[model samples]
Target chain A: MHELSLMEAVRDQALAAAHADGAIRITVISLRVGELAGVELEALRFAFPVAMAGTIAAGAELRIESEAAECHCTACDAPFPAPDGCCDCPRCGAISRQLLRGRDLRLLSLEVV
Target chain B: MCRDCACGEPAPDPAAVPASAPRELTLHTALLQRNDAGAAALRQRFAAAGVRAVNLLSSPGSGKTALLEALAQRLDPTRLAVIVGDLATDNDARRLQAAGVPAVQITTGQACHLEASMVAEGVHRLNHQGISLEQLELLVIENVGNLVCPGAYDLGESLRLVLLSTTEGEDKPLKYAPIFHGADLVLISKIDLAEAVGFDRAAAHAAIARVAPHAQVLEVSARSGAGLDALIEALGLALPAVR
Candidate 1:
């Protein structure tokens, strides 16, 4: 799946950053995954060890934090969470045309020795 | 009961601290930073070359190649070029070439989507074939046949075209919201078979409106020569004088 490739990107950046900071070994890799980022967390977990093998983060623990999807209603000018995958405004029942957040897949922090 | 403070219960030895203790490093970075940077560079290049590029994405058998083939006949062959990507084989490229268009194929061994680097390589190959980006009015990149992965990649295209055939069902847009939401133009392909296949036009249009409120939807049939002119006008490729 594409999660493997995405994890490879994570591994590359983690190794690069760990080395740049004069760290010996990585202990934890922290990530911020959004609900609407088009990635499956289960698939990402499955790809983590495969992508991190033979690197400083070989045995590192993967910590993922999820961000909920949010949408902005153009007609009602309201911001609401899209937990049910519906893009309609809760305030006025108008359709939300703008997506404000919850599409991020970021490496937030890392712990290295 | 602190260990190293003046009001602590016990004093700590300075030598007891581990020298190689772990450190927390804040490196808030996007996972696709590298790909996004490549896309930004390519976008600058396209803008400098005055070329309009469109990235097409769809599921397998969604008529992406067919739409391009139809476009080849309508657009100027000398000014238009295409770069196609697939898991294997250059058959799509050959098909477009046979339809009288300059086409380059990038056969990604295992990748489900075309990254910016692959597009750059494809452009290089097209240039090697004497089709420079500067001379082209429109450059179409037919991404790998996928609905999920391609939605996350930006290949420096001015427009993002997504296709959904009549046979794919009406709820596809909502099911694959990420891809459809990112589309600048949504083409409902194989409209000629809509009536025969019982494709609910109203439901499909409603689904598209729900997911992609800002996208312009066009119903097209590559075989029946329906909506091709509108597709060309929507792309705003080039005029005869410019050619």
Candidate 2:
């Protein structure tokens, strides 16, 4: 899975930030992973420690804030959460709903010593 | 010392101390920020070099190699060279080479998709093999044969070309809309076998248009050399002129 690479990136960023702040170790890494981001949380967790080896983030906790898939209904001009495998707007029952969010992957914060 | 030890003197046990003591370090960093930065650098490099890198995505046996061979035949050899990605084997590269252009293969061991880093590495490898991007008109990165994973990763390409063969059902685009949505062009390969395979070209085009309205659709057959000129013309228009 690409989660190894993603975790490597996370570890690199965390290490760089920790080094810049003169921190001895990283405590936690917080990330916002969207539903449609195509990242598997379990896979990410499985790969994190391996990727973090020898880095500041080694043995650090990974905190992921998962976001639900959301869409904007073109017919009703309303925003709603989309169910898995179905993008029909919950309000107007229209299938032509435009995706608004839930495809994001962002590193929000890191807790370090 | 025995008395102190027996009395349980307040001394930190060297064995009790963790080999690597856990420390309180707080760092705020986005997990993907590093890759994004690398990709941004690659984009700048491509732009500066006036190189338009196009990533080709498709399923296995979808004729990606054949299409590249056809493209090499049609394209000016002095201007084009291809970099192919595969899990193993240099078959695609060999085929492209047979067509008279330099080709390099990046064997991504067990990696389902080619990321920007792999592509950057591949670029270096190609350069070491005497294929310089400066003299190239187009750098076609034929991504590892898959539909789902490759759609999620951007290889610092200027454009993404998704190839769907006519033998596959028209509903493929609708089913794999993520790949279709990410594509700049949707090329329907194997048009020669359309009627034999009961492929409805119009319906297929319509499905693609539904998912990606902005993507240009091209129907081509590498076997018969039909509809390849249009693809070449499109490539000429999309790729920046190499000096």
Candidate 3:
């Protein structure tokens, strides 16, 4: 639902990166999306072109890499997959101590010029 | 190719790009970085002023306004101020203002969530309206009446409060586990109507524990002035001195 603003940030970051490198055209924007990042990839894809239109990133290919949410259980010293940041370990049923992954909405790389 | 040429020259095809030769720059940046920075700045300001900023989250009609009003009457109005966010109207702010406290309304035109930047603006407006940050002991921000978008935003609050009305259902915590889990305090509002609505107290408490075991749960009725004292004490607001 709020992916439009997030895509705008991506567009701005991609443009800044391209401008810093003296690249006039951005060929591709690669993003790392997590399952628990509260971002919908399809919605982001839909908003990308609209946000990047008329900019240096116009017509750029948006490549997305999806990552699953993972959690760490400090109780039993185990790493496991969990849905959200707060999750009980499947192995021990103890509350996870740390969220290992799946909350990242990283603009990983940009292909430009 | 002519730069800025109005001629109808087709742009290069993005699909047929040779990936082997493309120059890739590694730019690992999080999308929420900007918002995070803003939140950090707000937190710094709150720390400097020695003020506790509380972010209140709940669904619509959860009596967030009523609770704030009750607190306003209990505490020193000069020490407490509120920032209310709504989609269309400033009625919540008006209600809080009627309680004789400084209240600012942030009407999110299209945005579903209130971000750190909005809090900054709201505080600025409140200050402009004669509520200085240095004098305020507490600043309460009542977020928009939604559980989803506000969960993702960090408004640089000293504490995060999530409210659940009994009429909403006992399984609300289970339904919205992420938001519930993120809360520092989970308040059950409108307990006065619990018996009339057949609100299952045990089930709700169990659900809240299952989802947010770390959060302190308090049952309150804003209308009856029930449990507000316990809340004030939990917040360490020093009611007797302030009142």
| TM-score of candidate 2 against the unseen true structure | 0.77
Compose the digit string of candidate 2's lDDT tens values, residues B103-195: 889899999888778888878987898877888878888999887677777677888899999888787887766567667888999989999
Query: TM-score, chain B only, every model?
Result: 0.90, 0.83, 0.90
Model 1 alpha-carbon drift over 4 Å, by segment = B1-19, B238-243
Better of 1 and 2 by TM-score: 1
* Interface Cα RMSD of candidate 3: 3.6
DockQ category of candidate 3: acceptable
Task: Place model 1 in a CAPRI quality band.
Answer: medium
lDDT by residue (A22-95, candidate 1, tens digit) is 99789999999887777889999999999999987998999999988789987777798875345767788777
lDDT of 3 by residue, B1-243 (tens): 324585667655656754345588999998788998999999999999999999999999999999999888888888999999999898999999889989999999888789999999999998899888889889999999987668778899989999999989888887776677668899999999999999999999877875665789999999999999999987878877634
Per-residue CA lDDT of model 2 for A1-113, tens digit only, reads: 67887777777777777787777778788888876666778998899889888876778888899888677667887887754423655676666436677667777777766
Q: Where's the lowest-lDDT run of ten residues in candidate 3 chain B?
A: B11-20
Error of 3 at B171 (Å): 2.4
Tens digits of per-residue lDDT for model 1, B1-243: 565576856665557754478799999999999999999999999999999999999999989999888877778888889999999998998999999899999999999999999999999999899999999999999999998889888899999999999989888988888787788999999999999989999999988887776789999999997998889989986534442
True contacts kept of 3: 0.51
Worst lDDT window (10 residues) for model 2 chain B? Answer: B21-30
